[model samples]
Target: MMGLRGINRIVIAVRNLEAAKKLYADMLGATFHDAHWTGAPFGIHVSIAWDAGIELCAPMPGREHDSAVSQFLAHKGEGIVTVFFGVDDADVAVSRAISAGYACFHSLDYSQDEMDQHLGGRFCRYQESYVSSADRCGFGVALARIDRKPG
Candidate 1:
């Protein structure tokens, strides 16, 4: 069985990233540790507060009219868009989740080297799988297999 760890991270889609960041900071006293242009294949900006397990995402101006973030914000307003869970094995976790009635939208695997660069030198291999929102209470759920021992 895949070892299912607890909540890994949460991604909130917002219309304005900075405003959302400030709101969260004011409410939770959380500081964002990193900011990046995410939505790689698409277009969006993301701010991450790793300590608080929060990721705030917003559409890039003029470039995101058709991006998923923009569509989500247009439909749902600012709200939780995705949640991630830490797992020992992404394949097994995804299989289990599918058996439990969840539908996987897609999955990806990242080697240690790729992840290191993506994470700014945090070296770890991992696999990630996304379960569609339609299958999980109208919010996307993702499983991540991080190369780390559970504490």
Candidate 2:
């Protein structure tokens, strides 16, 4: 059985990316890096706050209606969308969550193509799986395994 080591990251969905960035920066006194567009496929852009390791995401304008970030914003407004936890092994954690009766609602692994295009040709191996909110007291929780070798 897999266990969550700790929280690795928190994903926040916002309606206005700039406004949210400014707000978080002021509140945390943090600096940020260049924005990353997960592209037309994900229809979102994200800015990572290095100090807090929090990712601020907002849906791309044209795709707002269909993007997951938009959906989250609609459902819960400007707040945390999900929490990603670090695990020893993603596959094992998934199996354990399933065996414990939590359904896997979403799964994402950084693909080679995505790494190449979005990460400036650097490879970052990571897998994340979300357990259904129903099983986690209505809060979305994700388990992730990151091969922190390099990016």
Candidate 3:
């Protein structure tokens, strides 16, 4: 059995990242970093509140139709988009999900060095796979494995 470690983060798709961040801050006391990261390939801007385990995502200007986040916001109207599960191994988790009749749609693997460069030496090695779930379970699921450097 490939057991998940825990809920890593809850991704919320929003029309405006700043507005969503403010809402979360006022309602839940969540504090996000000043630097907003862009997932250019996905055509979205991402902001995360690590302590709150919430991630806000919004479509980039002029690329509204190019990503899943935009499509989700358009269809469902700003809401929880994905629940990311922390796993020991993303590949195994994805395989288990597939065996369980779930469809895996996308995957990403990043080495520690790569992530370090991308995050200014703050992130760990990461692997993730996005699985389809909305049709049956109301929201999408994602399996992720993050190997953090030991203290």
Candidate 4:
């Protein structure tokens, strides 16, 4: 069971990993979790302290141009697709949010150090609406309900 604490990070799935990496690293002054989780689904590339986590998730192997990331790329043409909220009790939050009418995207349970590595924070996302800098959904993939639990 996880609970909402505050925002820890956000994941922006991109089509080009290197391009997004250089853009965020040089332009946004962000850093990667490690060099290992670049192309992995359950891993991220950038880790922000108190802001959004922009993940340029690559369409690796059989997942080329036809996956969630790819769909985001095709529709929005490369940018933030998923937002991970930093919460406390994930299960509890999801249950509460669903009861309140929010749809669950998914849930994750892994050691931050062993995987995503941003203070070991585990998180989840809701289909709530959020206005990206692009104003795609008037609220695109809204708020990422998360927990600040140490991974």
Candidate 5:
């Protein structure tokens, strides 16, 4: 990616997806997309779009493992984990990230739940990465191009 975009999505690593969704959607004026069972060991993923769609991905509750998301909560103490970017080629973008020494979080299978949940019918595809640096605010998340609202 030549020019990177602003912070597109703020992924919150929370234990309670429903609680997070309630707070964000009801109190914080966040318009939620839809929830999905990621098929990962994790329980459910709720896509909440306020100004941006922040994916609230939580572990399946119990059956804890030394996974990256687990480490994220252990280290950063919840909030924003990964930053997504919509690039021309995910493979090429991933290659560039590899060259830049950035750890890439591979693409999610596919979720159309968001469109089904939202009243306005907004949709988007998110790709992200996490760069570790103990000194710089614990860690840093960067989002590239956020392709949304469809063509």
Candidate 6:
């Protein structure tokens, strides 16, 4: 069993990251970090607006066809791709989700060192698992556990 804290963030797949960020900022009065984050493994460029709990993602250049963001845009055309739930343990959440008959399609684990190098020590450990419940729930779900360093 896993205790889900709350909605961590809602990821939106978009054709243009900049335009989407601007749109979200204007619409929701959101503020996003100036520096964009790239998930090379997923082949997507990501931008997160912490205050609004929104994340915008787009396919990376030259990896458009192979990226999940691109595929989602091609099929659905810029919409909510995944809603992430905050959990105490992502692995436990994923296992529970699987036991409940959900299919997990992607997972990632980042260690403290990796987080320090990539995220500037803001986060210590980050783990996530994306579960597909689209057929039943009409949307994708993701479980995540993020450990932030103390200020």
List per-prediction Cα lDDT, in the order shown.
0.78, 0.76, 0.82, 0.50, 0.56, 0.83
> For candidate 3, lDDT tens digit of each residue in 1-151?
6767999899989888899999999999998863344376788888888779898888888888877587787778999999999999787899899999999998988767677766555567778889988888899899988666666
Give the residue spans of candidate 4 off by over 4 A.
1-3, 34-52, 111-151
Q: Tens digit of lDDT per residue, candidate 1, span 23-104? A: 9899998878555634645677878876688988888787567766887888778888899999887888988988988888
Q: What are the per-residue Cα lDDT tens digits for candidate 2 across 25-62?
A: 89988676545565346888787764686878888888
Candidate 6 per-residue C-alpha lDDT over 44-88 given as tens digits, one digit per residue, 9 for 90 to 100: 888888789888888888878998677678888889988989999
Leading candidate by TM-score: 3
lDDT per residue for candidate 4 within 36-150, as digits (tens), equals 2433553333333343255456565566656546666677676555554544545565566567656655444544454335343343222222323224332233344433444
For each candidate, give its TM-score against the true structure. 0.83, 0.78, 0.87, 0.60, 0.62, 0.86
Worst 10 residues of 2 by lDDT: 32-41
Superposed on all Cα atoms, model 4 deviates from the true structure by an RMSD in Å of 6.3
For candidate 4, which ten residues in a row score worst on lDDT? 124-133
Supply the global lDDT for candidate 3. 0.82
lDDT of 2 at 129: 91
Error of 4 at 88 (Å): 1.9
Q: Which structure is stronger by lDDT: 4 or 5?
A: 5
* Better structure of 1 and 3 per lDDT: 3
Segments in model 5 whose C-alpha atoms lie over 4 Å from true places: 39-44, 64-68, 86-92, 103-105, 108-137, 140-146, 149-151
Off by over 4 Å in 6: 34-38
- Model 5: per-residue lDDT, tens digit, 20-128? 7788877768767655533254443556564655777666556234444676677666677655544545556566766876665544323456444542445465444
Q: At residue 112, what lDDT does model 5 achieve?
A: 53
List candidate 1 stretches off by more than 4 Å.
33-38, 148-151
Candidate 1 has an lDDT of 0.78
